[model samples]
Target: MATHPTFITCSSVSFSWPDGTEVLDDFRLAVGPGRTGLIGLNGSGKSTLLKLFAGELTPAEGTIRTVGEVGYLPQNLVLDTALRVDEVLGIAATRAALHAIEAGDVAEEHFAAVGDDWDVEERARATLDQLGLGHIGLDRTIGEVSGGESVLLRLAALLLARPDILLLDEPTNNLDLHARARLYDAVDAWSGVLVVVSHDRQLLERVDQIADLREGEVTWYGGTYSAYEEALAAEQEAAERMVRVAEADVQRQKRELSDAQMKLARRKRYGQKSFENKVVPKIVANNRRAAAQVSAGKHRALHTERLAEARERLDLAEEAVRDDDEIRIELPRTLVHPGREVLRLSGLELQYGARVAGEFELRGPERVALVGRNGAGKSTLLRTIAGELEPVAGTVETHVPLRFLPQRLDVLDDELSVVENVARFAPEATANTVRARLARFLFKGARADRPTGTLSGGERFRATLAALLLAEPAPQLLMLDEPTNNLDMASVRKLTAALEAYEGALIVASHDVPFLESLGITRWLLLDGELRATSPEEVGSAVR
Candidate 1:
């Protein structure tokens, strides 16, 4: 209810796609100063709304008012992969200077459009430095940096816009632990309004509020991420209760309607029998005129009786209710017994070029995490484990039937129907059996028939899990590579629950610190190629 400074406010605002299709149905949100986190499952219109807020897309109806400028960092924004890191920053500085000139605050020859204090190069370098992209050696090409680093560089440019508000879309995707920590720190220190669409719980923990986009509407929750989570849990429980109550009511009304219809049918039958046998024969035998009058009276009575029956049946049927789909879940069976030594690395090493893991060994269900600076081979280790890469090592052995959920959904056949995609994993399954199994994961009827390409990221992840589980027996060992990357809140919660109950061995490598903690993984291997193992407690002690 308070006025927002340096924030955007949407009032009865609506938008449609270029095809004149509706997206937001009079959607409303008050993004104010202080950090606010946006959370919704994929295709919930998070990105589209952010674009509208940034003025990239105009609302088709109502008004969007902004009190101040804004800075937006989009998700994994692709750079001119050909441009050098320095060149990109240099261009950004020039653009900012130009914007200042166009705003009539600076002379065309000087970026001091606002004041004599505007230092374009100094400010640009500072922003880039804060994001840890300064070490790219000025001349280093963007292509030379890893995919994650390039993303960060682009974010640095956006931040330098010096806007009064910030809208970040999935900012943590592909980020390493150090980089993510830096972003958290930056956001914590930010004075402007911040609205981010992210699935990372750790990032949200520091936020002042959380909001969700669902069913073409927005719902805001006060307090931190943890509070929002509690609120959502309570809401879900309430919704389920309402659904149950509705179902019970429907059943009760259905029974009443059925009984009433039967009674009406009997009444109509009685009227027919009374007219045919009791009244018609008497009319023929008695005085023709008197009998004819009696017959007409009986016919009139029958018509009135049938009309009453029809009204009663219609009223009863009107009270019955319709039904909806029920939610369910099923994980595959497991057949893996991890070796006494869950993972063994003997003279193990991974090299993308000049990197090496001298030698290391990990054992048991000890729950080890990989962490390091950017380009430090953290992902490479997981890649090697998932067999996405051939370890340039002595011997890396997984003594279990490992199921690897890759960071990306390359295993999915985009062209196939959702049911078919799951079916392919179980070539021996009948079409009906495959469909039935997939339906448990929320892909039912036409949804199952929809092409895999049509599924949102969360659905795609579920589809992948369903397919993998359909095997004769599930794999005992599970390997998740950046499992939380770009996942929705519901999917993240569902996955965290699944991982917690998983038996055998578990290996997860991710930048999601909160997720790892929630799942009880305390040991981490900092991968400066050494893969040294240390309990999170130990690291905490050392840092302290």
Candidate 2:
């Protein structure tokens, strides 16, 4: 196979919506055969940029140039009709043909678009076989597959296209840890130029570079997401220092300019008349000129220059902070009263269809972590604790005020704006008051008015937390189910940072080991018949 040229290049690009929303300015990005982590806040336009590359939306200004075939994956794709997994992959083989043909780069115009990687079609078959999906019949209907399975099948189809550049947006959001890890492995193995947007920290860390979009611009950093973050922080700190120095200089200049003008004014006003004969006209004229030159506009412009510097520094600082979009639960109030035994379930029983609950003894702070495999009743137990479910015959003792941020954040009213959501959460709050608070979470002004449903997953989580925090005493017990599922790495960091500072207890269930470890989780529980907290290692896949 012949090597391809650069996959894509963007220069002096600026983009925005038809409604006059600015996504970015002077944005630039260059990509090739390596992993690149694409990131930005909810409204940061990461998705918009991808659309441009996909030929779905044209850039409002500037240019985007690319060579070779491209592959794209989107988060939360809706697949209609019925088709088998193998059929989808096979269908993809047919689709790649048009693109290569359109690009006029195929060795042969009539050559099949997607086919065997090597000299045979078996190469493509082997890829699907490795994914444990070889058995899925192409003749079978697609509707039969689970949501996760559907996502996997879609990925397989995209992969089979074998484009030189792949653009993936939240490709891992709907997949389980096992499935997600599998996708990661495929990405790692791929020789194609991979550009992905994901909140998954582990995914971001694997990328060769990070591209940050803000204020209509993109900053390219050399290294992984973490390294880029550290460097950005350092840059922000330096910018802040420069701003401070500039501001001080502006103030001092203002005072000196004021004094000079005052003196010049006095000299001009007097000498032109009674003392006219005593002083030279040239001296008076010179004084008048000097005083005129020192107009208020000049003074204001200096201050404006200083302010511009300050603004730049602030923008840099904000960009660095924005990189981590995960929500931090800032409980507005701290409440305590629960004893060491925040939760206790003895002989606690649970049943789903035909599966019986696992058995166990669990007692600890309100900060309990329910650990179990999917469908193992971890969620069932949480629902039970939240009164969403009733145990068949187990004694239950819980003492705490629990507020749950579910794996799904539908608790947020999609029709309402961020501000509206906050106001509803704290109905007692005035519109101005709610807006002020949401602004702190970066949902400022019109952004707060954007429909909650319009927000990116990261933005939605932040808004959800903001709504929760508005509660007066704050929730004493915070229960999170699959909390890190949709959050990006930056968002996860912010969320964990905030949660770490929280004084209230926490109960979270998730399969993300990295997230669990960062939270200092010690014990785990299985969805057996009852609730039990055990060692972290014990938090393995239990039979449902």
Candidate with top TM-score is 2
lDDT string, candidate 1, 291-327, tens digits: 5456555655565565555555544444332222322
RMSD of every prediction: 8.0, 7.9
Give each model a TM-score.
0.67, 0.69
True-vs-predicted CA distance for residue 533, candidate 2, Å? 4.2
